[model samples]
Structures are given as structure tokens and as C-alpha cells.
Target: NIIQNVLSPFKPLPDVVHRITAFAGSGKTHTLRLLASAYPSLKILYLTFNRDDDPLASEKDNKGFPSNVVRQTTCSIARKETQAMGNFEEPRKKVVRDFLERRLGHSLNYKVVDVVLGTANAWMMSSDPELSEEHVRKGEVCELKPEFRALDFVKLAKALYDAMIDPHCHEISMTHSTYLKKFVLSGAEITCKSGGPFDAILLDEAQDVNMVTLQMLLAQPG
Candidate 1:
């Protein structure tokens, strides 16, 4: 029975978004770690609740990152090699807003594309206008649909599943819809391109994502 279940090839549902619901300490993070490790090139973005009082607490707490030595893996090494050109706070916020507005703008010369639609993008989009505008101007325009359509729960779910199944596909832009009190996805589309485009994108804490975030991921072309 154990062998059978282990060997069982579970056929995923059409456009199925693999959602693993696990109890606390149920190895959810562990599973992600395994997947990321197996695919060395995979870029994963993890967004956890503000469990820490200090945002930069982790940086201070894990003096040498010995605690996350196991989970960080090659991902951390790559991060070290490609630390942000400067601080990423401003740029990240801009990306988030541009993602939400559904408008693509050019920063340098490359294009800013959306691989997935998620709340993070929405939250960022709605949070600050100036920052969002800067992101669009700095980044290239993503090839989003002509009309800015809001993504519902169902559509968001489909987008998530689509991103996970593709190898060429990378990047997950999620938005947090808590502060502004928005639930569904809504926004307008803008166009622009970047000087240097991104290579990959990853989203962690997929469960906590909202509709807006999921829509950003769906904005990507399969």
C-alpha cells in the first residue's frame, strides 16, 4: 500500500493549481525547500506574515544565516552574488504598483513583465502613486491585455496553477489587499519597457495571497 501510493502518478486537474494545505509544522516550507533545491535555477519569493516586530530583524537575528543554512541553499548564494543594485525597497514597491495598475512602463530599456498576478502587486499598486509611477518609468512595459480586467478568486487560482506548471515561466507578483480593504482584482493598464529585463520571479507563502496578487501572476503569458 505504501509503495503503491508513493508510486501513484497523480494526474493534475486541468489548469490545476497545486495547493498543499498542511497543518502547522507540516513541512510546507520543507516541501518548497525541496522543490527549490531540486531546481537550482528556480527563483522563489517567500512572503511571511510580519511575525517579527522588526522587518530587518531576520538580518540581525541570523548573524551568519546559520539558521537558514538548510532552506537558503543555492538561492541564498545567488542572492549574495546578485544583491540589489542598491536598496530594493523603492524598486520593489514600484514593481508592486506597476503590477497593480496593469500598466507597463520603461525604466531603462527593458520591459517589466508580469509572470503571475498576485495581491502583492495589487497592494503595491494601490499603496503609493508616486512610487508606482517611478517603477513604470524605470522598468519596461509588460505585455498585459489591452483592457485592465480584474481577476476573481477563480481566475486567480488558474493563474497560480499555470505558473507552477511551466519551466520557462518564472516570477510571481502578489499584492496584499488588507490595508486598502479591497478584495477583488481591479486596475487599469499602462505600457512601457525596461533596459534590463528580469530573468525569474518566485512567490513564497502562496496561501496568504489574495485575489489581486494572483491576478498579477495570471497577467503573464503561458
Candidate 2:
């Protein structure tokens, strides 16, 4: 059924979003592969949570994407976009150490720095443009009483958010979550090497995507 629907040759594809939804074990990938073959020249963006679905990786035996197709996870896009702004995790840790030790005059141990950075990252995953107390409360991946630890994780998370957001304070690269969030807010589109937008976007496992990430992908400017 899907094969006939999507693989019909010489069919005029309307310039609009074409969504394909079906239950598990369905021939979704098979159909998509057929669609790509039908129109080999179209640039398509294929998104999925499973690494196996990514055609770029050569290690796996899965059906890889065609040369005209680009596969990316939401996290990969975020990190790629802000790579210049936020170098790497280890370097980010060193920057955090300097900030705590010099600018704030508060010496944070390695473990505490990890916890704070982790918490800040969690907050970035949220839909909020700016970090808030409520977001901190929601961002906690761990379940613990408020007064259980010697280190105040929520407060530290806020401090880290402030520093990251304020470019004038110091130079700390932007986090993936922050950069991804900004990408959505800015309403930008992913373009091709020839400076043209993608012909279409294929989002697999759409049910698992968060509201903010989904919004960001769907709201891209043509």
C-alpha cells in the first residue's frame, strides 16, 4: 500500500509537508528507500533516534542513506551548529573551573563541576528560552530531597546558566541544548551545500520527540 502511494513515478509532489504514519513492523523504511530511489536527485533529511538508522555510519549493517539524503539526530545538529561557540566537554570543564575559582571566588571540586554542568545541560533540554527556578526543579534527572546534599545543585545550575548566557562575563562555549533551543527560536532552516533548502524532511519515530525539538524542526523557514 505504501509502495504504491509514495513510489508512483512521475507523480507531481505537492510543495507541502508529506507525513507518513503507520504501526510498527510496517514497511516504512522500505517505502522511504523506494521513494528516494524514485527521486534520486531530491535532498532529503532523514531523522531518527536509532543510530542504526543513520546512513552515515559505516560500522553498522543497516540500510544506509543515499548520497542525496542526510541523516542527523537532534543532538548532533545542536552540537554541530554551536561547535565554534562551545569547543568540547573537557575544555568546557576547565572553563567552568576557572569561572568558579577566579570570577566567583568559589572553588568547585571536579565532581561538583560535573554535577553543575550536567544540571545546566538538563535545563537546556527544556523549552524555556531562559533558565528559571521552576526549570531547575524540572531539569533534575535525579530524585532526592531538597536538603539532602551539601552542594546546592539547583543554585549552581542557575549560576552556570547565567554565565553561559552572558557572553560579556567570559568565554564559555554554548551547550548543545542552549544552541538547539536558540536554533528553534531563531526560525532557521537547514540548507544544502549549494545554498538551497532541503527538498523535504523525514522524521522517523516522531512520537518520541519533545515539543520544543519538534517545533524547531517544523518551524524552519523555507
* TM, every model: 0.30, 0.58
- Give the C-alpha miss distance for residue 104 in model 1, angstroms: 34
Query: Which pairs of residues collide in candidate 2?
Result: 85-173, 86-173
The CA lDDT of each predicted structure is 0.33, 0.61
Candidate 1 TM-score to native: 0.30
Task: Give the residue spans of candidate 2 off by over 4 A.
Answer: 6-25, 38-41, 50-67, 84-119, 138-159, 162-179, 185-188
The C-alpha local distance difference test score for the whole of candidate 2 amounts to: 0.61
Question: Please, what are the lDDT tens digits per residue for candidate 1 over residues 71-186?
Answer: 22212222232221222222243443343344234232112224223322443444332222232321212344324222232333244433322334334322222211122122
| Tens-digit per-residue lDDT, 25-83, candidate 2 | 79676666566666777877777643232434643524555788777776566545544
Candidate number achieving the greatest lDDT relative to the actual structure: 2
Task: After the best TM-score superposition of candidate 2, give how far the Cα of residue 72 lies from its true spot, in angstroms.
Answer: 3.5
RMSD of each: 16.4, 6.0
